[model samples]
Target: MSGEFNLIEKYFVDQQAQRSDVVLAAGDDCALVSAPVGSLIAISTDTLVAGTHFLASANPRWVAHKALASNISDLAAMGATPAWVSFALTMPEIDEIWLAPFCEGFFALADQYGLQLIGGDTTKGPLSLTLTVQGLVPQGEALLRSGAQVGDGIYVTGLLGDSQAGLDVILDKSNATKPFASELEKRHYLSTPRTQVGEALRGIASAAIDISDGVISDLGHILKRSGVGAQVEVEQLPLSQPLLEFVGSSPQAQQYALTSGEEYELCFTVPDSREDAMWQALQDIDCQITRIGTINDDDKLRLTLDGQDLAWQLSGYDHFKTN
Candidate 1:
C-alpha cells in the first residue's frame, strides 16, 4: 500500500471498522449495506474537481464542506434524512495541514446533520473529491419531479445568485481584499443545503429539486418530468441584499440570477390550496420560503419582467458552455 492509503486506513478506516450497522465497509472492493424492511434507500453522488468546481488554490476546509454539502442537497431533494457518506479523495500529495482542516469542516457539518462517515478511499492523483451519500425515507414516500401539476404554486427557499456573486469576486482577484469580499466569499464556500426544509416539505410539496444549476434550469427538470410549464415573475425572484448591491439591478445581473449555479436552495411546487399551510410549516422550521410563480397548463416556460413577458435568451448553467 502507498503511504497516503496507509494513513487513511490507519487513522480513518480502522477507527470505523467496528460499527454494527456497517454490513460491509473498508478493506473491500465495494461496500454493501442491508436496509431495513419497509424503508426506501436514497443514494446520491457528487464530484468536485479543482479549477472547475473550485479553484486550485481554494481553501481545503471549504472545499471539503462543499463536496459533502452538494451531495446532501440531493438527499434533501428527495426528502430523505441523511444517514451515511463515503468519500473518495484524489490528491497529488497529502498535506497534513490541508487534510486536518478539511476533515474538521467535513465532520462539523456531518455531525450537525447527524450523518456518519462510514468509509472512503484515498489515492494519488490530481486534486478531486467525490462523496456518495445515503439517506432513508419511508417506502413509496420519496418526493419526485413527476408529482407537479398545473396550477401548483412554485416556491423557493432563500435568495438566489449570491454564490455566483461570490464566484465573480473569486475570479476577479482584485476584489479579494475588499470590505464585502468576506461575505461574498462565504456565499460560495459555506452553502447551506436545505435538509431541514426538505424534510418539512414531505407531505406538503408536490415536487422538489435543489437549485444547483440555477433556478430556471433546475425548474425546467420539474417541468419536463411533470409534463407541465410555468410562468414566473422575474421580480419575484428572491435576491439577497448583497446581491442587489453587487449587481445593482442591471439586466445582466437579472440573467445571472436566472442562470447562476451552486445556490443550493430548494425550488418546489405545492398545490395552491396548501400554500398557506406550507408557508406555516416552513416558518415553523425557521426557513424562508418565497412564492415565485405558478405552474401552467400551457406547454411553455414563460418569464415576466416588470409586467412584460420576455423570452429568455438562455435557460441556466450548462456544464459544457463557457458562460
Candidate 2:
C-alpha cells in the first residue's frame, strides 16, 4: 500500500462491511461486482459538505450516516436492491477518533442493507463525503419520474418535515428546547432509507422519487416528466405529532412539509387502480404510507385545505439560489 492507501486501508478498508455481490473489494485497481441475473444495475452518487449538509461541528458518525443514507435513498427511489458502494472521503485532518465513529456509522447502515464497500479515494481537504451506490433491479422495471399519469394516486412514505425540524434544532439551539427535540434531530441525522418498501413498490408504482428536496419540489419532477399536474390535500399531509409540536401550527407544518428538504422519504405515484396493490406491497415494511393527492390533467400545481385552494407560493429547496 502507498502511504495514502495505508491510511485508507487501516482506517477504512479493513473496517468495511462485506457483501455477496462484490467480486473485488478495496486494495484493488478496480472493484468488480456481479449484477444478479435478469437484473440491471442502478448507480447514484451523493456528496455532503460540511456547513451545508451538516453543521460543521456535527458528530462525525451522524455525518457519515447521512452521507450513506443519501445515496441509499436514491436506490430506494428507483425500486432497486442496494448491493455496493464506493466512497470518496475527504478530510481536513486525520482524526482517528472521528474516523472510527464515522466508519461505524457508515458500516451500520451498509450492513443493514447488505451494501458492500468497493474501492474509492481518500484525501486531505475540506470535510466532505461522496458515495457512489450501486443497486440492482429487474430489467425494464425501475420506477421513474416520467411514469406518473392523470388519475394516478400520489403518495409518500413516512412523515414529512422531520428533517427540516431537525435542521431547525441544529441551526438554532433554542429549538432543542422543544418537545421531542432530540428525536427530531436524530431523524435528520440518522437516515432510514426505505429500501425494502421501494423494492416492493416495483410494478406497483408508476412513478417514484425519494424526497431529498422536499415533496412539492421533488414530486414536481414527476409532474414535469410525466406531463401531468398534481392536487395535494394540505390537511391530509402526514405529519408526526413530534413535528407538529416542533413547528407549532398548521401553516408552519405545511410549509415544512412542502419546502424543507433532505428527509429521504419516497414520494410516488400509482395508477388509481393500483391503490390496493400499493397497500399490499407495503404490508411487510414498517413505515407509515399515506396517500396525499391525485395526479391531474393540467400542468398546474395546486394545494387545497378544507376544500379551499391554498394560495401558498413557496418553492422547495434550491441548491444554488440566493435571495
Candidate 3:
C-alpha cells in the first residue's frame, strides 16, 4: 500500500465495519452516504489541536474521543440521531504507538451510538484531529434554539463545571485528592454527549443547546435565537459529588458552577404544559436532569444566587478571545 493509504487502512478504516447506507468507504476519492427518505441530515465538524485542546503528551485515546464527542454534542443539541462520520488527522509524524489507542477510542465511542466511520484523510502537519459527524432527524421535527417560549423552564441534563474542574486537576495535580482528581481528569478528557436525551426531547423541548461553553453563555444562543431572555437561579445549578468536594461551598465553586465549560450536557427548555411529559420521558432514562432557571418576557439575562443578585461576567471559550 502507498504510505497514505497504509496509515489510513491500519489505524482508521475497518473494512469489515458494516453500514448499508455507506455506498463507498475510505479507499474512495469521495464517500457516498445515503439517508432514509424524509429524514434530514445533521452535520457537525470539530477540530482539536494538540496544545490548544489537549496536552501534547496527553493520552492519544482521549484526544481522539474528545474530538469526536465534541462534534457529536452538536448533533445531540439539534435532536439528531447520529449515523456516520468522516475523520481528518494531521500529525507531525506517524507513530503507531499513538495511532493504535487513538483508533481504539474512536471506534469504541462510535459503537455506542451505532455511528459509522465512513471516510477520512490523513496528512503530515501540526498535530490535530478534525471529525465531521452526520446524524439523521425526522423532517420538520428537529429541535432548534428558536423554539423557546417566554415561560419555558430552562433544564440541563447532567452536572456542570466538571470539565473545568478537570482542567484544574490537569493544570495542577496537587490541587485535589488522587481519586477525586482522577474523576475530574476523566471529565476533562471524556465528555458524554447527551445523544439519547436530545433525541428524547424532540417536540418536548422548546429549545436546545449543548453545554460546551458555560451555561450562561450557551443559553444566550437560545435567547438570541428565540428572541427571549432567562433568569437563572445560580444556587440551583447542579454539581456532581466529586465537583462539590473539589471546591467545597464557596464563591470559587459557585463561579465554577456558572462559568466553566465543556460539560457537553444538554441545556433545554420545556413548556409548562409539557412538564409532565418531560418528567415521564426522562424517568425511563438513566441520567440526571435539573431545572435551573426560567424564560422571561424581559430581554435581559440575569442571575440570582441564594436569592441575591449575582453579576454576569466572563463568558465561556471564545476562539478569537482566547487566541
Candidate 4:
C-alpha cells in the first residue's frame, strides 16, 4: 500500500491550475494566499461520504468532480470569483486507477475556474472526500440570503429536478430509457457551478442561494434570513424535457423539481426595479434564467398552480430527516 505522503506527491501536488494569488501551494504546514485589495474572501467547505452522497460503485472521476463542484457552488452563490481550493481524501485503500482519474477530474474543474490547489491531506479511513474553496468578492458587494425584500421577483438559473432524476437512474429506480437516462445521469454527476451567472447577479439579485437541497428548501433559507415570504407558481418551475419524460407527468415532474436535492442551480431574488437590468446583465452568460415566483411580506411560502392555490406536503433534503 502506498503511504499518504507518496500519494499526495503523486496525485495532489503541482496541479494544472496556477494562480498568482497563491503564494505557497501544497507540502506546507499551511498554505498561503494573497488577499486581493478591496476584496473580501469567501470560503466554503463540503464533505461527501461514500454511501450518503454517492454510491460506492460510482466512478472516481465524477466523484471528484461532484466534490469540488459542490463547494464551488457555495462560492458562486456568494457572487465570488473562485481562486483557491484545498482537498482532503479519506479512503480505506488507494487504487492507482481510481487515484489517476480522480486527480484528472479534480484538476480539470479547478483549472476551468483558474483555481489553485493550495493544500490538503490524504488519510486512511472510510471512503469520503472533503474540499474547502476560497473566492474573492468586492467589499460590500457579496450576495447574501438576507438581502431579499418584499415584492422582489424570484428567479432560478437552469433546470431543476434533473439531478434527482439522475440519481434515480444511478440507483436503478428510473424507468427512463437510453439517451435520456444518460443525460439525466450526466446532470447528476457533472453539476455546473454557475460562477459567471452569480457574479453577474451580484448587484442585481436582492438575495441568492445555490440549490443543493431542493429549491423549496434552499430558497427557504433566503426567505427566513430576509424575513420575507414567497409565492411560487408551480406551473412556472423550470423543468427539463428529459425530467418530464423520466417522470411521465408534468405534475410529478414539478414535484421532483420542488423537492429533489443536489441540483446546484441558483435561486435568486431581484427587486422589481432591477428586473430589466438583471436580464440585460445575464444575457451574455450561458445559462437559462427563469422567473418562478415573487417575494412577499406575508412571511410564508405559498404555492400556486394555474392561478389556483396548491398545497405542498413535500420537503427537500435534510441531513437528519433523510436517509
**Cα distance off (Å), candidate 1, residue 179:** 6.4
- The residue pairs found clashing in candidate 3 are none
Candidate 3 regions exceeding 4 Å error are: 1-5, 176-179, 318-323
Q: What is the TM-score of each candidate against the true structure?
A: 0.91, 0.95, 0.94, 0.95
- Model 2 ranges off by over 4 Å: 1-5, 318-323
Quote the RMSD, in angstroms, for model 2. Answer: 2.0
User: Which 10-residue window in model 3 sums to the lowest lDDT?
Assistant: 314-323
Regions more than 4 Å wrong, model 4: 1-5, 173-179, 318-323
Sorted by lDDT (best first), the order is: 4, 2, 3, 1
**Model 4: per-residue lDDT, tens digit, 88-147?**
888888778788898899889998887888888888899888889999999988999999
Enumerate residue pairs that collide in model 4.
Answer: none
lDDT of 1 by residue, 207-272 (tens): 999988989989999999999999988888887777777766656566777887888888999998
Better of 2 and 4 by lDDT: 4
Tens digits of lDDT, candidate 3, 43-121: 9998888777887788888877888889899999999998998888888788888888888888889888878888777
Of models 2 and 3, which has the larger TM-score? 2
Write candidate 2's Cα lDDT for 78-174 as tens digits: 9999888888877877788888888888888888888878878888889887899999999988999999989999999888988888887887789
The clash numbers for all candidates, in the given order, read 0, 0, 0, 0
